[model samples]
Target: MTLTFAEAGEQDIPDLTRVMTRAFDDESRTYRGLDKGGPEGYDNGDFFRQWMLGYDETTGYTILLDGEVVGGLIVWIIPGGHNHLGAIFVDPAVQDRGIGTQAWQFVERTYPGAKSWRLETPAWSLKNHAFYERKCGFTKIDETDSPDGVMFVYRKIIHPD
Candidate 1:
């Protein structure tokens, strides 16, 4: 399938909400300790969008597969040469298919001036840990437990020449 990154806009909220909510369904269930259903859920795009508004240097993109939205991401460019990966999610139905990897590569190339990359993920997400550490070349620098769950902070330094 052809994968592409499309700039996300305000009108894309419903689609983003649908894709990301489904994308994070498994993680939400795991975090909430619910096998069937629960109150607290994941992929609250409205909440995420509100949070992103606090960042001055953020960009959002929708992951499109064959012209269909399958996932989305938000990135913040730090002034001093660092790039923070605010969020990245692929539809759970389409996970493990390398769509996220390609999308990330596109982001990296799109922001070539970034000297480092930083992001955080839930400690409970073993698959995410593996993907970030192995496939994405990030190192888990630290992890801290919160009321919700443990958050793992990862970092990757881009080679400087």
Candidate 2:
């Protein structure tokens, strides 16, 4: 399918929430396993909506597939450093179809002068780590954890020359 990347506006919040709910629901199932009976604590549509809408407008992009809202990435440009790719998710049904990769490449091409791109994923998500490293060209830089949880941070330097 032909996917398009566009600047997301406040009006797109609802559709974005729906897509995220569906995507994260699949992830919750993957991590929690089927024996949980029904969806556990991870299905937080309200939280996703709040987070997505809370993003600063100047640094985010939403993805549309075949003119339907599908996914997005919230990029934050740190004041004195690299760009941070805060979130990127596609509909679970569309995963492994290169939509995420294309969306990422679109971000890079759109912002040609960025010094580097950074992102963090849960340490437990091995599939995500492999995808970011092998497909998106990111390398694990460091990791951190607290009583809260652990996350692996990855970075890819983008040279303008």
Candidate 3:
């Protein structure tokens, strides 16, 4: 699938909410070992509200497949030319088609000056672990235990010459 990204705006909130909800529901269900509501007992609306409340348009992008919004990501370009992948999600229906990998490629090209990229994911999700390590060239840097669950931090150092 052809993938592109557009800057996320207030107008995209509803679509982003749906996409995020659909994309993460399975993980959320598997995460808590039951269909509680979301990854951490919160529903889609909770996630949407948090995103809307804390969103930064300058660092948010809606992932589009052939011009249709399919996913979204948030990245923070921090000081010292480093960056963080605040979040990235692809519609579960269209996953395993290399869209996430391509999205990361797009991000790398878009932020050519970035010296490194970092993100965190649920430690129980081995699929995510492999994707970040194998496909995205990230390394497991650390792990943290939180009230929600264990999270593994992944980091990829960019070598741009």
TM-score of each prediction: 0.88, 0.82, 0.85
Task: Write one digit per residue (lDDT tens) for candidate 2, span 1-161.
Answer: 77998877667667776777777667657875632211122244444344445555335567988998889777776654577887888888788889988988898888777888888877766777878999899999999884435779999998732
Q: Which ten residues in a row have the lowest lDDT in candidate 2?
A: 34-43
Q: Model 2 misses residue 122 by how many Å?
A: 0.5
Best by lDDT: 1
Question: Candidate 2: where are CA atoms >4 Å away?
Answer: 34-58, 146-148
lDDT scores in order: 0.78, 0.73, 0.78
Once model 1 is optimally superposed onto the true structure by TM-score, how far is the C-alpha of residue 45 displaced, in angstroms?
A: 3.2
Candidate 3, run of 10 with poorest lDDT: 36-45
Model 1 lDDT per residue over 1-161, tens place: 89989878766667887876775667667655654321133345564456444466887888988988998888999888888998888888888999888978988899999899999887777788888988889999998886657789999998553
What's the CA error at residue 42 for candidate 3, in Å? 7.2
Q: Which stretches of candidate 3 lie over 4 Å from their true place?
A: 30-32, 36-58
Candidate 1: lDDT of 78? 83
